[model samples]
Target: MTDIIIDGGTLTASRQDRVVRGLLLPYREECRSNIGRFSFAPGVVEIPQDLTGMSLNIEHERERVVGAVTELRETPAGILATFSIAKTPAGDAALSDIEAGRRVHLSAEVAGVKVKDGKGIAGSLFAAGLVEKPAFPSATLLAAEDTSDDEDDPQGGDDTETTHSESEYVDEDGNVWRMVVDTETETDGDTTTTTTTVVEEVTENPDETTDTEEEEDPMPATLAAKAKTPTPPRGRTRQRPSIADDLPTLYATVAQARAGDQQALTLLAALTDTKISGTGALPGAGVLQESWQGQLWQGKSYDRKYINQGTLGTNISAAGKSGFKMARGTKASPKTKLGGDWAGNKTELPTGTANAEKFGSTLARWAFAGDIAREFFDLPGGAELIEAMFRLIAEDYAIWSDEKALATFLKLAGAPVAPKTYPSEYNDSLGMLLQGILAVKRAKDEPSFAIVNSTAYEQLLYTPHEKVPEFVSFDITTELRGTADAGKVYVVEAADSYFVDADDDPLVDEGEPAVLVGAKAGVEFDELGEVPFTIDALEIAKGGVDRATHGYLQTFEIRPESFVLIGSAPVVGG
Candidate 1:
């Protein structure tokens, strides 16, 4: 069998009273498998829903049951379920491993699957396994608390949970049989289906009941109500709009407050909902006065961008140079040892010429601006509104600047690596990343990092790989524009800009979807003049002020050989 590899999150434990909780199955999360890419939507798993009696096993082995699911609820993120660890030695060990950071993730086992568009649209969650590696990054084992004070209580602590029970008895053939019974009931319309999983673990010696190995029956006992009519295929279900769905119009609110409208000012104050100071400024003055200039303070936020010349490569001052020049060295042999014919005869050394080229950066002005009516200055929240507008523009510019940086880098990265088409047989994004890293290494530069769009990054987390090279790291950006282009990732030695796509025309086979790479030192970003937030009163007739943030990005030197662009087949149903 082909080996499975996955990239994702780590299991973490935190003290939260006596109960253990975590995200069980993340909804709409896709993962790459040996067969291909797959994921589970909210309705895929069919069960009693609460999964009260669902067993928790080790590596999907039902016979090695360690615990049972006690509670479950559907959450926006996914299904959040709680587990009741059994009191057996195996259960104790599993719990100990989880709390000690030994056992890391959870993997769900399902049966009777109905797949559509690479997702488990319909299936049954038979059991969940505690494994070292899991397919879903969000399938975390958050915490496991031992409810039983007496860790060695053999009755398995009947007082805490009644979802499942175990009993042992000797058969006529002098064999010990351990019976695990799970009970659950659910009603769909008028019909109710009751499921009971009775697993038998056989052992020759009663003392070895815990050590004995067994396999669960291929099919569990399920009682179904007779159908009165054939059911139709499931279709899309409608969801009610949520309270947060009603988005507020911040621009309108700010505009009205600037006109000295009391109602608008009150509404704005309520929306901001903070201490307000009426110093002829906008309501909730503190928040409106927050500054977003000079630095990317929101860099840690997922929506904010942090990539730039300095981040990917060396950032240097323009130093007043219109263009930078460098020589491309041609391969030449070293001089032969000066032996035998030393003084009189001299042999000509291998000669090679170096090509000199000059490269210059491009300068472009970028800013975000807003216009406010003059009357807004009369209201207390008016100044606050102006400050808020400036903050919004600054945040927007920060994100846009990164997108421009990435687009420029892709253009200058040059052609894609040789044999660029990722292996068609493998639907693994992580594999494609590994290929890109190797390609950069072949170019004689150790890859420093890689960047992929958010979509491709999700694929990477699900695509199972033996191991990701420790030498390089992965970075994700929302700015890697284009739907089809999102499937590609670039491995780099550093960074540069002004990219030329390797393939002008792409095919369904996934060759050259998009190319982006280069050395950072090769690119120069010069912010000319001050990026000041300025406000100017408009013409008297207009009676408004134009607020803008002004700055220019100038100069760059690109080195194509320092980066490799890897592309994969666009994921189906993505």
Candidate 2:
């Protein structure tokens, strides 16, 4: 009780790449499709050959489609006929179905057919309804048969033979006065006569010569399997892949890492953009940090040893006084002198190892669900997710480094910076900072950069300071540095200035916002390993459940003496 078509009609894929449907097909083959149920078998139907390249209203709608027969194959079920919608004005309506992966019924004019397996003339095929989708064929899969078998006959070529020829002639008057004559003369008493006949047929190639049962037999285990094209290969069509059925998958990078080979590591780098150097205890959050100059320090701290700014006192003291008289040849107490005094007095280096407060971050924000990890790996945005994680790790490292430096700064700035005397109260911040920068410039032998809060910067902006005329507000990374007034004052953001309380709430009054100053080498950022900033993941046993611990080890230092802040510095773990 569905719409029954006696001839050319729809087919259903047995799996992804195969289908068995045709006119005069065998069995009561049924298929599920969006177009509804459409059955095809031979009936008393007649299809005209003239309609082979013509259009038909297979849509069963207003528009008619030009149906072009793609192939008429002898299938295991029966004759499998496949057709495509021609590119025409009316065919567009039918093509929409094909493009949408929707099946359409084939309206065929079957004629002069009697039985289910009987063959007859099929006039035109029109796609009518919708159905499930199927896969297209590869070149080798469509191969039907081979036909490179035509060879020349043995005795059909040029060869000499001994024979005689005779002829009879009659007048146009129809009087049988036949005259007989020998047409061949004796070639040394031997003559040759040869006759050849050849017959060939001009076939339209309609018959399905290749009877493919079911694609092909699987390759045996004994032989190496390969693809082969038929000597008379079937035509291969280019069909786009179906996006709906495409399923993405996750690469087993984590599993591959177990191998620990160069190739495995390389693949991990390509996927995660990071290579594992070694494994150790992930550093805990603390005050001690490595500086940009790659040295260990606590806060805005530095190291200095007793170095003779100039030469100290001599290795021996003057053998004067009572010692000279009592002991003439004895070694005297050695002492070094300051610039204009005795050698005994010594002074410490201006800068010494001031602090070693631990400062770092522990990456603990993790979605403990393993399913989340799987999702990140399997989703289309997996690469982006991984990249974002890497960036956050770097940012976190920089942030903690900055905080440590700020803490050092708060300690170094005088107890009473005693608001400097200036024309405007607000504008005084600029003058105060300029005085600090001038000192840093003298010590470091180069001008330094500064960072302050937006409010402080606004104060500087209102300053009537005329010396910084060629000024512009821009970041250091801006490309047009040459055009900027290098001698003028500028500010950078103190990335780690904010502090939070135990509740993870930003503290309203930890201290005044900070202003940091640094030269290229003024701040030391000690790196612990070759790759200080790295991605780390591990499985931790917590509460009897396995959880992944993803963290970073970015060890760096920032000198506190280089920065100035208005508020108290945030302590570690704040």
Candidate 3:
């Protein structure tokens, strides 16, 4: 029998392989065999654990001891020696030129060949030397050897596995057994089959039977192996189900789309726009404008009016008789009455150069980084950008817009000059507000709305805390844009009310100024067939090269009211 030898080991720079030296050889104990004193496994030996200060004699020459053996251990093959080079001048020079890797050639010797009584050839490692550097990949630790049954392990010594024939003659005390074999037959008007077989002795001695150990064949390298999928046997898919009846419906729908619906055209346009815009956002740009999403009128420019606010007709609910009476002397008729421009008599919308700006970076990188289009509407600043554009316009508008509606509502409320330079807390401040509401009701016979800044509204909210006598308990009904228990003083909150610093009207320089407005008092925003406030995209460029991502807002006839100035507190230092 030939001995098995594996010649690979590890020597890391850390010098940590001490007990691992036992891996180089199979581990077995010494035993007193019938032949004499010897070991069942010869390579097993006690090895030194620490050799920290011991020097290594390269090829048994003390003159070449460049490094010290820091650690050593007994392994299956031989003792593992871990060493490190000294940091001396000579050691450093030697290490600098020495190539590093571990797979040294080791010498081995066998004692004798026998089975029982330890007669089998026992392999033993004798000498180990560092020769040429190894070419194969190395690891920090040695691999565990295949420890299957000696006769069955694929490494060597096995040939018991077979499958072909079912029966063969065996004169073993009337016992029957299956014999596996293959046969071939040739015919020239004659047939023949041939096979190979061997007979074994029924031995009771262990030493004699040990010689029958079989060797296993090596595996083929070219074949790929995988776990077999489990399934119920006796099943096969031979045919497919039929669905020919549904074809007519599909064809009819296609034909209908081609002739009537123009679905192909719609699909083409949608796909083209999506590709060009690269904005495959979800259904809507989900933005949270909870303050005022659907509060105001959302209609086309044609739905608004840009005519004179002072001359606008009040005949919305004016009554007249277009029907004639029978047998009446000249059929009694009454003329339709029109009211003068009592509200917004001089509330003029000023026209100036439109101010606009853009603040967005190029989306070229984000657009090309991913294959899918990102939904901009879902982003933090996505759809809100449209609202932001309008808000910018509204901010400037709030600064200079006339307060015609406010003044008109106040006059109807009998508080025409109630907003004095130093008006009482709720006496005139809140009283004038409620009175104006009631006056509009008396004159127009309809309810009136007042819009104020959030700051002034907050004050009204804490009016009772300000030690006021009129306010019992005012509640902010943001949803209704008014107060709950405010009786007739219905107030609305303007998110962008404090957008300006101070009003330049010169009427009053009071610190806080507020504007009050009615629903039907302001001029209208109208265009031929477009929305009053529209958001459009522009491909801005400087020298014919598209520069940045920008948006445009088109607002028409957007005139705010003439802001009213609030009175400062009474000076107590008399």
Candidate 4:
């Protein structure tokens, strides 16, 4: 059994806001903890000045950080903080437990503690945890209702009250107060709130008031009246149209709908209650992908340029200029007379030079074709099932493109770039990236982008390094974890780099930016014959093929001198 602590602690969590806010330590309130009786005063315990990255875990598990402390302040209640929960599964579960009136205790993991005379003194809160049973029983988690979710909402648009709940609290004087808030809304958009707080004498057993269960229920009159209203019987009202009934029909005709089947198209129109086009072209991947930009990877690869052909040449001229120089020494400066013939003392300047390099790009064809049995369309949820399949294929394609681009970048670099080692004071991932950027700057190029695996990026987010200039942009993708090692950072000068779609030329009159005038990725086209070609073979008798063929033609160019690859990217994957 875990020891419990009760030191006038208080905590509240708001699932809608994704935040857990409460008193961390009860100042001047003595509490019995697992380590015996301990309490804190204003100056007894020291906390981090900035609680920016403090982890909030579960059951004191160091590895399962579910949230981070976003706000903290010292108050009469001891230390108060607002923790923003992460969107991970554990985080969601913890918040749900809190909202559902479970796992109501919070435990503080303090470090550097010096216990003197049964009191903890001079310690820092290293982190906090959400536990089923905490050493401090008063550190209970309360469901904080969003007042804005009620009427009295300042937004004024909706008069309908959205939420109603009751909560209890223990004041410093040990008075138990039950708070009931009633929000009434009218059709005219008027909002009002009635709050009633009933105080009760401190009972012999504080657990009766502190525990969420076995507590007195102070029902608000307004809420009681609303609850007393008889609920209408289910299904007596007219039902709204739902697409569930037509799912089978839609699935059966989905492929034919894309192939311009009149019967299939008509059924789909009636099912969806909207007219679909007769052009034989159902919504392509673009429809589902539009919300994520042209291609998922391209959104992150912003430093892109376009070219029409597979081969291109670039010329880099030498920086130094050639010019005639006169003798500069005091003795030889005036040796040549103005009117004299060409003299031997005149010095000739070296000739300027430039280097030209031609590079060719080859198109890599990637196609995703998924086949579903013809009978699948007749099954429930087949439409969604097929879409999910294609979605996975699309995601795989995105990862492949991302890895391919990283590989191309690494290949252009020819060798791993080592940033100038920084002093111990500036030793961090962000510092390394800064040094890498400096290296690129020394090459007469500007470092505009940095690419790192998601793991490295997360470290960069918390690294205590000097502020990076606004011009330098950093991006993270999981694919980089495979291409570039998780701990590696790749800083590059990609302003002039381009992703070239060499398939077709741009229309000069369209006024499209030259950078965007090319065939984008995620394109679907038929084979030499109609896509999902009808097979006269016996396999057709089993069930017709349900296939989607998607392919794109594109290549990219990153000049050898335009990028600097920093950190370790193990050459392992194909």
Q: Which candidate ranks first by TM-score, i.e. highest?
A: 1
Scored against the true structure, residue 573 in model 4 reaches a CA lDDT of: 44
> Model 2 lDDT vs. the true structure?
0.32
Q: How do these models rank on lDDT, best leading?
A: 1, 4, 2, 3
What is candidate 3's lDDT per residue for 26-58, written digit by digit as tens? Answer: 222122212222223433333334444455333
Top lDDT model: 1
Q: Report the lDDT tens digits of candidate 1 across residue range 1-574.
A: 1112222222222233222334455555555342344556655565555665688777655689887877554433345445677777997788678777777566555555444555556656555666666554333323323232213235543221213434444434445534343434444445554444434345464453443344433223333343222122222221111122111453464456557655443211001212456654446535656664534455443342325432332232445335544453532533333234334357555444454456655666676566778777766756876776676666666666666666555555444543344565444455555666566567665444465444445555554444444443444335432121222333322222222233433212332223233344545555534443464657577887776676455546455666656544344465
Question: What's the lDDT for residue 477 in model 2?
Answer: 38
Model 2 per-residue lDDT tens digits across residues 310-428: 11122221221111112122234322322343444585443212222344312212111221354454467665655554545444444444554444333333232333454543354
* Total colliding residue pairs, candidate 4: 5
Misplaced by over 4 Å in model 3 are: 1-68, 71-74, 77-429, 438-447, 463-475, 478-480, 483-490, 495-574
What is the alpha-carbon RMSD of candidate 1 to the true structure? Answer: 31.7
C-alpha TM-scores of all predictions: 0.36, 0.28, 0.27, 0.29
RMSD of each: 31.7, 26.0, 26.6, 32.4
Residue 155, model 4: Cα distance from true site in angstroms? 98
